[model samples]
Target chain A: MRTAIIGAGQAGRRTAELLRGLDAEREILLLGEETEPPYDRPPLSKEVLLGEERPRGLMQRAAEVYEAQRIALRLGEKVTRIDLGAARLETAAGECIAYDSLVIATGARARGLRIPGADDPRVLTLRSIADARALRARLRTGLRLVVAGAGLIGLEVAAAAIQLGCAVTVLEMGERAMARCVPEAVSARIEAWHRAAGVVLEFGCPLTAIRPQPDAIHLVTGKGEVSADLLLVAVGAIPNMELALDAGIAVDDGILTDADGRTSHPHVFAAGEVARIWQRGAGRHVRFETWQVAQHQPVAVANALCGEQKPYAELPWHWTDQYGRNVQILGTHSAALEWLEREDGGRLIYFGVDPEERVHSAVLIDNGREATPLRRIIAAEKPIQRNRLLDPSVALRQLC
Target chain B: MAWHDVAPEGEFEMDVPKVVQVGEDRVAVFRLADGFYAISDVCTHEYALLSDGFCEEGKIECPLHQACFDIRSGKALDEPAEVDLAIYPTRIDGGVVQFQL
Candidate 1:
C-alpha cells in the first residue's frame, strides 16, 4: 500500500514516520512546499528571534533518517488539486501522483493586516523560517518595535525584543491579552508581568492605519499614532483548507475530521492546524494550534489508516516561555468551569472546576512540576475536594 | 571506573531524583519502587536537569519540553529527545547510596 502525505510540516513528517513504523513494507511519500527539510516552529519566536540558535538546529530530524526509512521526501512541491475519486493529487508543477491513502496537513498561514500601507514590505508577519530570519536581522539593540497584537506570538516576540534591548509596544483589540483562549484572571496576571518587564501594552487598541517612511514605520491605532523602526502583525492565522475544499471534502474554517482523523472522504484524512478534530469532552469539533497537538494527532491518524481505532481525543495543553518564565495551561477553557486560584510560595496556580466538582482545566505559572499530577487528577473525572486542592501542603499526586 | 558515595538511603524519595555532584559531573539518583538507579543529570535534548523532571512508571519527563526518558535504562522514549542519556551502575552499601562512573 502507498500512503502520501501533503505539506511536510510537523504533522506530515510525523504521519509518515508513524505509518512507516507501523508497516515497514508500506510505501510512503512526504511532500513539502518549502525546499528546506521539516523543522520545528516553537523556537522560531524565541531562540531564533534572539539569535541564540541557528536555523539548521531546528530540523525535526537528520536528513539521512528519511532516506534510511525508505520514505520518499519531495520538497518544494505544492499540491494544487486532489482527485478524491481517483485517489490522486496534482501538484502545482502539474505532476500527478496516485496513492491508496492521502493525508492533508497543509497547516495554516499568518493572517495579514487589512489596512492602508499594510502591503508595504516593512509590515511583517512571523510564520515561516524566512520570516523569522528577516525579523532576527532587524532585532537590533535600541530598535523600536510596535507589535499589532497581544496574542501569544505577539507577546512572545515582544518579550524577545525586550531582551534584545529593543523598545517594544504591544497593541491589542481585546480588553486583555489572549482573550480567546486564556481566562481574564490569567490574562491580567500575564499582562502585569509583561508591563513590569519594560513592555508598553495598549489594550482596546486596534491598528487602523499604517504609514511607512524611509526611516521608521508609523502605525495608527484607536488611541494614537506610534512610530517604530519595525512593525509586526501578529494577529492570528488562517487555515490552508483550499486544497481540501476544492476536492469537495468537508470544511468549516478547517477540514472537518472525525474522532479518528478521517475526513468526509474515505481515502483522505487530515490533521494539524488545517483540520478540526472531534473532541469528546467539548461535544464538538475543535481545532487546536499547539505544538503538542501537531506532534500527537498524526499518531492516531496513522493508526486509523492501518485499521486501528486510536481516537485522537486528548486534553489540550499549551506552554509559553516569555522573559525566562514558563507558563503552562492544561485542558480547554470554557465558561462552565469555575476558576479557583492557589498560591504556593511565590508561584500561582489556577484550577478550573466544573459544577460537578471535577477538575476541568488548570493554569500554572512557573509551576510545571505539578502538571503531571494535575493531569492525572483531571483525567480521573471524579469529584474532588476544593479545600484539599487549594491547600498547597497537600501533594497533587495524592488527590489522584 | 570509580564508585562515589553520594547520599544516604533516607535522603532519596520515592519516584524523585536527587542530584549529587561527583567530581565535575552531576549525577541524578532515582529511587523507583524497586531500588536506586543513577543516570546523568543533564537532559540529552536541552540544557535541563533531569532531576527536576516528573517521574512515574520508571520514566522521567523533562520539565522543560516534556521529553520522556526511561529512568532505568536512560533510553529516550519521546520526541525532541532523540539521543539516550548515560547511565551508571549503583549499589546500596550499609545505608549509603553509591554509583560507579
Candidate 2:
C-alpha cells in the first residue's frame, strides 16, 4: 500500500505517522512546501512575533521522529497537480509519485491585502515562519503600529506589540471585534482588556487606502487619517481548494467531505481548514480553522482507512495567549443566546445559553479552572439557569 | 466505624456522583450498578474536580478535556492524561457516607 499525503502540516504529518504505525510495509510520502519540518502555527503571532521564543521552537516534532518512523518527507517541494484518475501526484520538481491513497491537507493561506501600498516593505502578514521573522525584525519599542483587523491574529499581534511598548492601533470594519467567533458581551470584555493594556481600538472603521511614507504609513479611514510606523493586515484566510476543485472534487465554501473525511472521490480524503466537514449533531456542514480541529480530524480519516466507519464529532475548542492573558473558547453560540459572566480574580468566565436555557458555548479569560466544567456542560447540553451561572458564590460543581 | 452509620444502604444514585471532603482530602463518591466506589476529586490531567464530571456506567469523565477514568481502579482511560487518580476506601455507616482519608 502506497500513501501520499500533501502539505506537511499537522494533519498531514499525523496521518503519515499513524499510517506508518498501522502498516509498516506500506510506502508513505509526506510532501511539504516549506523547507523546514512541520511546525505549530499558533505561536507565529504571539511568542515568535514578540521575540520571546525563536521560530524553531514551533516545530511539532524533533528531526529524529521523522527519521525513526521511516516516513519519506519531501521538503521545499510543491505538488502542482493531482491526477485522481491515475492515482498519482505531479510535483514541481518533475516527479510523479503513484499512490494507493491520497490525503489533501493543503490547508489555507492568509488572504493578501489588495489595496494600494500593500506591497510596501512596512506592510506585513503573520502566517508562516518567514512572515514572523520579517515582522519580528521590524517590531521595535516605541514604534507605531496600525493593525487592519481585530480578529484573532490581529488582536494577538496587537497585544504583543503593546507589551513591547509600541503604540498600537487596531481598525475593525465590524461593530465589535471577533464578531464572527464571539458574542457581543464576550467581545466587550476582550475589548476592555485590550484597551486597559494600552491598545487603541477603532471599531466600525474601514481603511480606504494605505500610503507609504519615508518614516511612517498614512492610512486613510472613514473616521480620519492615521500615521504609523508599520501596518499589519490580518483580515482572514482563504481555503486552498484550487487543486481539489481542478481535480473534479465537489467544492462548496471548502472541499466537501463526509463524516469520515472521505471526499467525493474514492481513496481521496480531505482534512483541516480546506475541508468542509459534516457536523453530525448540528445536522449541517461547517469548516473549522483552528489547531484543535486540525489535530482531532486526522483520527477519523485514519480510522476510515482501516475500514472502520467513525463519525468526526468533537466540540470545537481553541485557546489564545495575549498580553499575559489566556483566552479559551468552546462550542458555537448564536446571536440570540444570553450571556452569563463569572469573574474570579483576573479570570472571567462567559457562558452563552440558548433559548431552552442550555449552555451552548463558553469563553474563558485567564480561567482554566472554570473552563473545566463549562466544556462538559456544553457537550452534555446541560441547562444552566442564567442567574445561577452569573453568580460566582455558587460552585460550578453544584450547578452541574 | 460501623457500615450502617456511614451512608444509607442505597441512597446514592448511579448517574450522579456525590462530592465528599474527608479531612484534607477531596473524594468523589459514586454508586455504580455493581457497587459503591470513591476516588480523588482532582483530575490527573489538570486541576479539575472529578466530582463535577459526568458519571456514566462505571467510569467518571473528566470535564476538562473529557478524559475518562475508571471509578473502581482510578486508571486514566486515554491520551492527554497519563496519570491515575487516587482511590480511597469507603463504607456506609448509619445512613451517611464515611470515606477513609
Give the best candidate by lDDT: 1
Computed on C-alphas against the true complex, the DockQ of each candidate is 0.45, 0.06
In order of listing, the candidates' clash counts read: 0, 14
User: For candidate 1, lDDT tens digit of each residue in A40-148?
Assistant: 7888898889885554336567668899998899999988899988889998999999999999988999999889999888889998888998999989889999998
Tell me how far the alpha carbon of residue A310 in candidate 1 is from the true structure, in angstroms, after superposition. Answer: 0.6
Residue A392 alpha-carbon offset, candidate 2, angstroms? 3.0
For model 2, residues B1-101, the per-residue Cα lDDT tens digits are 22212356567776577776656667778888877788888887545677756676688776554567999999988533557889877776665666666
Model 2 scores a C-alpha lDDT of 0.81
Worst 10 residues of 2 chain A by lDDT: A52-61
Residue-wise lDDT of candidate 2 within A1-400, one digit each (tens)? Answer: 8888898887888777767766778788889998878876877898787785543335457667788898888889899999999999999999998999988988988886788888888888888778888888888889999999999999999998898888999999899888887888778878998999999999999988889889788999989999999999989998889889999998898888999999999799997778899998889888888876677788888778777777789888887767666677888857777877788766678888888889888888766556656766777787767778887887676766
DockQ score, prediction 1 = 0.45
Q: Highest TM-score, which number?
A: 1
lDDT of 1 at A246: 88
Q: Each predicted model: what fraction of the native A–B Cα contacts (within 8 Å) does it retain?
A: 0.24, 0.00
Off by over 4 Å in 2: A55-59, A398-400, B1-101
